[model samples]
Target: MMAILIAMVFKLPVDSGERNGFALTVLLAYAVYLSIISENIPSTSVSVCYLSLYLAFVLFLAAMSVVLTIFVLRAHYGTGEIPKLLKILFNCTSRSKVDVEILEKTDVGEYEHEENKLTWQIVAVGMDTVFFYVYVVLISVVTSVLTVAYIIHYRSI
Candidate 1:
């Protein structure tokens, strides 16, 4: 089903940049869904089939977006090591730009710098998780409301 496909696509091994790209794609898809619905609506009554389709479409979009957002959050915050296959697929080489001599010269300083960087990364991951959950909840609520309204309208007709 569409939901399964969306979930699998989100789960695909990729770097942070690629994951962000997928998130943007989800947003674009939701926009397209909205445009399609707006174009179909008119002052006159709409068909049951059309309403039903709209409900299904919005629900699908909502589900995809919600699941995708969760995956994004996990990718950003989860402490799991990246798989070797994923590193290869993403073309990630374990090469550091820092000079070995410089690292050796400032061993204590380098450790402090690393600790600071880790703290900042944790804070960033926390913020991203909160933002993603808020976005997903808002979109899901809006889509659910629209779907319910459409169902009520269809029933009344």
Candidate 2:
């Protein structure tokens, strides 16, 4: 996992096949871990520091991914389009007129607040592609380096 994130940080050009394989491997590893663990946690073996660090990293990654996604969507579509995209993604099972009406009304009311919040963020992160990539690369590198150091120091001993 650290290696893969480091590769991304360095802009290492992996072919799609290798990327797909790596993604598959990570997913399978997680699936196996969930299946074997049964309960929520080890309850005895995992150190608190490691568990907390891992959770923090996961949360950080999720947040970064969300912001990056919003940037991508912003680039391709205007602020007005997001509500439609969100509706499509979130309420795919819409089957009634009332639902559609409520969604539209909510979108109209929320657009102003969203627009104000989104403008600065999009400008801050969307200054240039380089800046966006740099943010991701820097965070990934920092986290991966810590994780690598921890593993080498504790596990390799």
List lDDT for all candidates, in order. Answer: 0.49, 0.44
Off by over 4 Å in 2: 1-41, 49-52, 79-128, 155-157
Compared with the true structure, what per-residue lDDT tens digits does model 1 show for residues 117-142? 32222333333444445545554665
Which one wins on TM-score? Answer: 1
Clashing pairs in 1: none
lDDT, candidate 2, 68-120, per-residue tens: 54444444345443354544433343223323433476676775455333332
How close is every model to the real structure, measured as TM-score?
Answer: 0.39, 0.34
Clashes of each: 0, 0
